[model samples]
Target: MTNSAANDDGELSLRWSGRVSLTPRILAVNIFALALLAGGFFYLDSYRSRIVDSRVAQASSEARLIAEALRSVEPDRRDALMLRLAGDTGARLRLYDETGKLLADTRALGLRNMVLRDPDKQGRGQAAARFLDAMIDTVVGAARPPLYRERADGFAWPDVRTARSGNLIAATVWRAPDRTPVITAAAAVAGQGVVMTTANATDITQTVRVERFRLSVVLLIVSLVSILLSLFLARTIVRPLRRLARAAVRVRLGRAREVVVPRLPSRRDEIGMLARALSDMSLGLRARIDATEAFAADVTHEMKNPLASLRSAVESLSMVKDPDLQTRLLGIVRDDVHRLDRLITDISEASRLDAQLSRAKFEPVDVGTMIAGLLAQREARGVERGIRLRYDHREGERMTVMAEGARLERVFENLVDNAVSFSPDGGVISISATREQEMLRIRVEDEGPGVPEEAREQVFSRFQSLRPEAEEFGKHSGLGLAIARTIVEGHQGDISVESREDRVRGARFVVRLPLADRQ
Candidate 1:
């Protein structure tokens, strides 16, 4: 890549890196928020698990009670015992023989009695009995032991005989169950395979729903709180930076002597530390600029006297010498004297402004009135070299500003004189003023050879000139525009030159000054 492109890339990289480095503060806030959410999840998980375990324990107790009641019934009278138990417990009851054969059922007996008493009740009851039988069979076949226990618990099944479908079958004998094993009452019942029970999940589901709603509400509140806190944090972090940026821009435009960093939060954070450091740096920079300006002023002042004496001596020598040699020597001496004078003047003015030598006493001045007065004064000099001058006040009464009258007049005098000097005989110089938002813009346009494009940016640099043609012709010092710029900028304003080509086809200098605030 070209050097300029590479330099631009390097600058961009530095800016991006600087931005990335500032993200740690934002990241810290996010991490804190994440920690809060994680803690909430952990608390909810534990709470839900406890609720589930409590429900499971309650279901296990109920299952054990029913199993023990079944064990208390004798084999032959089990049908009547189950009927009484079902009425007391409000549950369906089924009894099976030792051989797993269908015997007598309480629901079936109810249907048979209904047939003897009422025919319609008998049909309805019988249908209901069949449905209940099928449901019990399905449930019993599906049941499995909730947990396994070792023989160390001291229980075993006894062998017995039974009959099923006209065939003999073996039956396992079981001992009486203990109440403690059944209802927090420990008891060993043999030959009774296994029993299972389940609790209603509706309450658990409701609890879960409530917990989720509460969690969502908590998270919403946390999110809202986090947003408000983040906004406050971002403002606190960025306000000082924005202030610094504005101050830097003002300094670059030569409108301020030093940047004043505002006080930050009392906490000793990185942002606070950076503000302090930047304040120190600005102070140091202002001091260095002052020192440089003082040195330049001293040098310029010291050189002026010697230069004036040398020029006087050269003029005195020229008057006594032979015509041909004297003319050539005189021209060389005069040119050298003019160059020295221009250099001294530019250096002096630049140093004075940099040092902020003094403030011009302010007064209410009408810009149009002042321009007219100056033009009349210049015309009285009787040096009209065929250049037509015109003054136009388009803004009328709006062009007035608060300024130092004499200083303001001197600024216009320099501009007008410079335009007159550059204009060819019969060329025109126009002065105009227009009102812009919060400012007054004054322009001086001359139809002469204009400044070169390449040299426009550096035209206000001290002693720098784009006047090669003038230098060859041995006429015109180049400090006029530079001095004008300094005076204009001193008023918290800007001055710039606009030109077309090397030859001064037309040159216009625009000055913008802030309008006086009335309220």
Candidate 2:
């Protein structure tokens, strides 16, 4: 089940690894939104229809006024009146008898106020206007009106026929040659003649074109601004992220030592925080790698000495036949084997200590009480080589720290054991716990040859021991101080060794831990 799940995850990762990134996706989202807004803007078909309806209504009103005047005026003066009204209204007026026969026409009588324009004779501007008109029609799905044409027989117009059939007024809208609206209206003339008015409504097209032009300009400007802002966002965000990603890739590809992660110290945002974190992580990983390499080399060198001694002792056992010599060789072999075993055990503990400490949960421990307990345990077991154990602290003072109890005890145990190894017979091993400001300071001092100032730092390093000459070989591994330091640091505390403060011939190991908050 796990293998199948892993395979599926690997496939998904390969599918979408590098196909699209942040910049293009951001631009696409912004442009898609703008396009939706543009769709709403360019839909002007309904507006044009409203304008055409208004023009037809206006034309019908003018026709009704002319019809009433023709009925009220003298028959001999009707042509002059029709021509004058046509000129005033900017439309052609035609009079027809009840039988659909044309009686009098405004244009025939000499008024030519309006004319239909030929699209072929117009300039490039008009052509572009027509192109835009067609585009708008297609986009908005406008239904085209029938084309307008003149007829000598007045009955050919539906509105004229309706007027002749006793209707008070009727109107129709048609498209002119240049795709502009042509509005016509007819009205009954005193129940005898029919009066028709026709206007080339070019102003409708110009008004729509003007409105479309303004909206187009607005859309263009908005689109430009949106694209520019998207690019700026990409630069501010994606560019830095890309640089960080590339640096991480370099680190992953074994170029960690050469790659310098950007900290972006100038930025005070989340990106800056992430950059600093990643940079610190990379530096810490590099330091860990170096420490591991040095540790491995030290372990190899330490193990070789014991193994070489064991092999020599084993070889000498076979070469000598005398019982006494053989007995000495067997003892040497045992000592070397014990040394090797002790070295391996300490090495394993040292290597796994960091991982264990990282996962440990800490609790408040009283430094004075814990040391007193340790001292009591030592007294129960009897001090080694008659060395004395002493613990001192303020009787009522609380010296508490947050730490893993067992690991913390191990640190003090190593310190006391180290002091015992160095102390002379019947010497004192003094342990003290005291509260110092925010820290719980514990010190273990021994009356022995003091550590040199130059060697104090090296003594805490793994496999770097300063054992007393009188101590038996293979009795102590040098990892005690190193392991104690590791546990101290893991608890957010520190441990160091120095000469005793009172000019005494002994080493003082001081451990400081931040005091836990008061409950």
Candidate 3:
């Protein structure tokens, strides 16, 4: 409520209300990315299995083709032919006779194991592939499966048994004794023996492993970006809200230190609206508190005057000997008591104004009808001071507005009674209503001394009196105008004093209220 805080509020603010925390917001945003990463991990596991199965199929087909080549060659020269086949398939080829005895071995050539160990070692293109494999295993902890050794001790293996039955079986891919991927296949060569192929499936496994490693790197990068974004959100949105909350607490506690309310109008979000609402509410509370305190002080001061006069009269009555003087003194005591009663009554009404207005249920009121009805009652009572009450508006017309009808009637009655007291003898109090755009304009003009420009506003303050010279003091309570102003404003209208348009000696009070949409 200080001038300093008021001035602080008027300055332009570049800050907005969206100071949100990035932590929670970032987590919310990354939800989709996390789901995608989960799906990728699942896909990788399935893809690794598929790769092994595909390599097994390929190895089986290679074994069948090599078996056909052995059948055409002479049995004695088959070993030299087997050496040529081993170089192509990168597998150790073995020939087994019908009795399950090993007839010839492809490793006699010494080139088969070298080819299987590092098939792509001779090519520079695969060097990067090997390095990536090592890196993926290091970072992701992709443990190698145990190696497998094929039993060839004159016993029929699954592949050899199935192949001799002409089934051309391909075994599942497994790990070799050297930690390389392994698969087996067999095919029978007519009048020769069964050709068994043992293949290292390291290429397929490495391919899947490298791809999964790339995906993991991508996921790590995305997680890092999401965290940074969350931090940014926290700074932009949440920080300002916390500042507002602290400012509100200071204002509520009536801190002696001035707290500057934030004026972050730049934001288009709900935070901007909240800041503005809180600022307005705080200012309103401060004004109400100041007004209530001032009103209470004024009430105490006003009440003291009557109490002092009555006390003086009572003390004087006991000492007076003259009967006539004693009667006059008693009357003075009665008059003081009456004044106190009237003052207290008006004070009570003024205090109840806010709560009564808040609890009042509003309805559409015909301003023309309300004023017309009030004017009739005042005229029927007959102004003892020879003041004539007149109501003027368009014939057969009405102007309505949303208001608490009974309370609004009280507003005009107070204004009229005040005007009657202030008017000269044989004076006419003119009340008129007219529609102006979307507003209803009403005026009460009195044939009395027009208010001075400086004193007009002060007249509506509690305990402020500007009564006529002829009017008896006790009959008028200065609170009438103040109460009238409060009631008018509570109805969302303004009441102001002005010089009457057609006369120089009379004062005019104009009221403008928003017109109701329906009759």
Candidate 4:
């Protein structure tokens, strides 16, 4: 059950993935990764917070220093000191009583150090900055600080209340009406009231926005490059594969002769390998189909001869009155029947030979031993008219090859039988096996007519015959050498016939197979 479910899940994933073509999938994955990187860059939110914290610390220190100065100064001199400190620090300085009553301000002292502006009263640029700040904050999920506002009671300020009650400095950061940070700090004077400092840190927002803008530019450039590379990759891989697929479909639809599968010869990648392999496969399949058609036509031609002979003999038997002629006609009828049977049997074997050899398991076959054994059997059954078979090989030498033993034996059997059919009665049919470099060579020589140079190759084709003039018609099916050649080639070997090298007036059939690895 678990395996089945896993298989189902795997198939479902394949189906889902197949819905989206390769180019889009590649683009989507790259864009998603870029989005993640952009999200990480947006961490400028924490960067802004750190900048505000630093400003708050500076404000707190300034408040403490101003409170100490106010404590030592006389009442009238304190206002001038506050005004000077506010002008130098670029912060508004204020003094409040312990009872939360407002006392003195930097503006009241004619310093006019800092002013908090309302965003609604600013220009379009400020509005755009505020909008960008909100977007950045939302993207990074930054904490939202309360808006900065003035209160009638100074003690109502959180930092101010804390400073007065605890007799210690307290700082707080607030968002201004323009979305910039406002840092405020309050310090309690020992013998006096509270000292407060406020500053607007606009540089923090500017810094974060600049970083985000730079990141956006980088992301845009990378996305464009990634998309182009994806398209290039898809063109190199997907286009060739699609061409191969369309060719295959055409081939499957019986248009193989017309389809030309592309062979990407210039590329050295796996896709190139696939294209070449498909091209080769299509060529091989097309050849096989053509051969099958030709073979069917040949089979029809071969069978029709015997069938027509049989039909004529049967029809003539009824019209003839003489016993001798009737007996001759009956003999002709029998011959035709036997000939047809033999032809059918040979045709079936030839048709199935390739398929069988493909599935055949091979073992080490000693060519010398196999040939000797075959000759021994033929000799035991005595050749007609004192005909003799001769075997030649080194007694103790190994001539092993990798092959299906039975099929290899059949190849030799056919060769020997073919030689016997051409050899004169009482003549020696020479058989020899020898090692030739990395191959095992066997030759069957007959003392009779030799095959013509031009007809040598044709003799191995299906239903081709080059029989002796003395041999009766239909004595041989003519598929022996053809089947033998097929079997030999299946074992990674070759077969050919030529005039005997010894200057004899006969033909020599040579079979060469790769020698088996001894180690």
- For residues 107-152, what per-residue lDDT tens digits would candidate 1 score against the true structure? 5656221111222444764455334333433544522212212121
| Count of clashes, each model | 12, 0, 18, 0
Tens digit per residue, CA lDDT, model 2, 1-519: 138888887777645435788898889989998998787545667788888888888998998998999999998998888888988999998889988899998888887877899999999999999988888888777888899998888899999999888788999989898999988999999855899999988988898889888888988999999999999988989999999999999999988889899999999998999999999999998998889999999999998988898899888878899999999988888888888888899999999999999878898888788888889998998988899998888897888888899999999999999999999999999998877788888999999998999999999999898999999877887999999999999999999998988866999999999999643
Better of 3 and 4 by lDDT: 4
Q: What is the TM-score of each candidate against the true structure?
A: 0.41, 0.88, 0.84, 0.93
lDDT of 3 by residue, 1-519 (tens): 248776776673325423534456456667666767746755665576677767777878888888888988887888888988887777888888888889888776565563345434346535654565555445556665544655755334677887887775545455643345778788888877688887777766567767867887888887787767767777667787888889988987885137667868897787888888877877777788888889999999898988998999999999999999999999999999999999999999999999999878889999898898888887887886688888889988779899999888988998898788789989999999999888898999999998998999998998897888887766777898899889889989999999987888988988888888733
Tell me the whole-model lDDT of each prediction, alpha carbons only: 0.57, 0.89, 0.79, 0.88
Ranking by TM-score: 4, 2, 3, 1
What TM-score does prediction 3 earn? 0.84
C-alpha RMSD for every candidate: 18.7, 3.7, 7.4, 3.1
Error of 4 at 56 (Å): 2.5
Please state the error at residue 61 of candidate 4 in Å. Answer: 2.5
Q: How would the candidate models be sorted by lDDT, starting from the highest?
A: 2, 4, 3, 1
Give per-residue lDDT, candidate 4, residue 189: 86
Model 4 lDDT tens row, 321-439: 99999999999999999999999999999999999999899999898999999999999987886778998888899999999999999999998899888888888899998888898
In candidate 4, residue 160 scores what lDDT? 85
Query: Which of the numbered candidates is closest to the native, going by highest TM-score?
Result: 4
Model 4, residue 417: displacement in angstroms?
Answer: 1.1
Error of 3 at 13 (Å): 33
